[model samples]
Target: MATTLLLAGLMLAQSAPAITVEAQPGLDQVGYQALSAGRPDLAIERISADPVMSASDPAALINLGTAYARTGDRTAALARYKAALTSRDRYDLELADGRWLDSRAAARLAILMLERGKALALR
Candidate 1:
């Protein structure tokens, strides 16, 4: 159901990718791997290395923010999300199951931060 919603949301493209798929080389894989490896610091380093790239790829910015959030750094996480909001560029992320996801990084980050805060409060 969430995947379906993501597909529906992605039907609308605000603009073409800032960096073409071919141009990014292994960044996507590297970022994903870094995040999956419990190395949010590395993930943030790689993803935010290029501000332009991060600004363009919603996935990267979201991941970058996620990295920060995982480290309990809400300030940096929110900064990345706010930066993502400044641009209209959205990325079409193809999942392993062939589903595509695309959405507003800032909005997603807002929800994530809220959830993180709630989680902390409960603890």
Candidate 2:
């Protein structure tokens, strides 16, 4: 009976849908691509050069936080994530796997993952 239950759980986990979170268009998108390419340094450079990226939008902040987290800068990452959480901007963030999330919801999720030492895997 235990073996059967284990197999059933494994099958359920495997059948679970994948979630993909896309970056905001433009610079945020570029930064996200850089991060995905494993170049967190490049992501930081691109996203940090302009304040406009973070000004009314949390997308860049979220990306920046992820990049910082990738680079092992937990403090900076948390700061960015926190800032993103407070941003007034609202938009639907579409994931690569076709799921949509509110930008703030994405930010909150990112924060939880970072706090738990998980790498931010959003697109």
Best by lDDT: 2
Q: What are the per-residue Cα lDDT tens digits for candidate 2 across 1-123?
A: 010000000011221211222343343442665765567798789778777764444667776887777778889988888887888766666554456666777778778877777544344
Q: 27 in model 1: Cα distance from truth in Å? A: 5.1
| Residue 3 local lDDT, model 2 | 9
Question: Against the unseen true structure, what C-alpha lDDT does each candidate score?
Answer: 0.46, 0.59
Q: List ranges where model 2 is wrong by over 4 Å.
A: 1-30
How well is each residue in 1-123 modelled by candidate 1, as lDDT tens digits?
Answer: 011211111110221111111114344422555555555688778777777767665555555665676676778767666655554765444433456444453345344644545101000
Worst lDDT run of 10 residues, candidate 2, spans 1-10
Give the Å error, residue 113, model 1: 5.4
Screening candidate 2 with a backbone cut-off below 3 angstroms (N, C-alpha, C), the clashing residue pairs are 20-95
